[model samples]
Target chain A: MSDTKRPLSPHLQVYSWSLEMALSIFHRATGVALGGGALLITWWIIAIATGPDAYDQFRTVMSSITGKVFLFAFTFSLMLHMCNGIRHLFWDMGKGFDLGDSRRSSKMVLFFSVFLTALSWVIGYGMILEV
Target chain B: MSLRSPLGKVRGLGSAKNGTHHWWMQKVSAVALVPLTIWFVSSIVQMTRADYEVVINWMNSPIVAVLMLLFVTTGIYHLKLGLQVIIEDYIHSEGSKVFLQMLVTFSCVAVGTTAGFSILKIAL
Candidate 1:
């Protein structure tokens, strides 16, 4: 039996992706991820307000190795979202629409996001070790 | 001179007018989030080893509490509007777009109010 359904155009596997496309996809993906992380932050705040037992449970989970990994990812996502978000704000203002500017800003976002993420982790680790 | 109607005079308005205010608000909130997010991250880092009372005390400060509320509320509002535009542009289905937009708005309000009320309860 022959299939009647038509194949979709421009599937991910078919096209060679560019840095701009990769960054754009990652920007949305990270945004959704960080939105979930925001909920986790809200839960932590609520737990702190509840009692010691609640706070302890939250702290226990968040302090785990897995939690640290996730938090690191969250930090990176946060930074990427922040940097890309600024790029978006510039676009909204009708700036940075030129081809060179777009590519330059995209590269800047990628570089700064990594730098900020590393900086955050260093500062976070220092605080943890000191305290 | 009288061939055309007066309604044509005021017809075709200038801008769409809807996006201007929302765009302005989003920028305002984005600027606010700069300091707010930095302070938030610092506060969370400091609370790494803090106990329940310490956490409560920090949030209970009127200034901190107000800032937290502002941060959460404005952040959600900005996110909601941004996500709405993204959905409108990308989501082809009208019903799905409306549903998603409504969901985004409701979630923002719910999250913002819940977080604000919880903070207020602890602080006051």
Candidate 2:
């Protein structure tokens, strides 16, 4: 009885996905994730203010494998959000609204997000390890 | 032909009074955060290998302190605005929506204040 295939509203499942759509959703997801990252940073600041011992403890935890992984993900999320946020600002100004430009900008956002995250991590590790 | 005044007609259906202000602040903060975030990430990377005292010394600089204050303030403001929009979009229940929005606001304020205080405590 449930197998009847009458016309129904075009929900997310019914529609084909595009890069633009995925990036738009990702922008919001990254924004939400950044809130948690902000809290983590705030905790770091507080630890620093507490004392050397507290700061060392904080650094120890954050330098661990799991914490490093989370930090890397947070870096990528921030990069994506930052890149797409600029794209959004351009759109707000009535620029890059054309189909071609919009798609191109979305591709650029993804590319830069990955590129910047990698660059940042490389620089970060290079400084930390003096490599 | 309607007897109601304009205000009466749109009393419940009218736009929220601060919609434009909210939208404008979000955009303004987004613009400000672009440079601030870049500076922050670069600074953090530079300090990645520094010890606690060295990090504290960096924070003690006047320029660093001021920028950190600005970055945390603007970052928290943007986070609150963005989170509010997400909650409004996804949370259909009016009760939970209001609750979540208030929670986001309070948390952002608390985080911002704590960060600002720490920065001040170290920088000054």
Q: Residue B24's C-alpha lDDT in candidate 1?
A: 81
- Which candidate should be chosen as best, given TM-score against the real structure? 2
lDDT of 1 by residue, A1-131 (tens): 15648765766778797778888889778877866776777787688678789989998898999888888898888888888888888898899988899999999999999988777766767744553
Clashing pairs in 1: none
Looking only at chain A, give the TM-score of model 1 against the true structure. Answer: 0.82
TM-score of the A-chain for all models: 0.82, 0.88
Among all windows of ten consecutive residues in candidate 2 chain A, which has the lowest summed lDDT? A122-131
Worst 10 residues of 2 chain B by lDDT: B10-19
What's the true lDDT of residue B71 in model 2?
A: 94
Clashing pairs in 2: none
- Global CA lDDT computed for model 2: 0.90
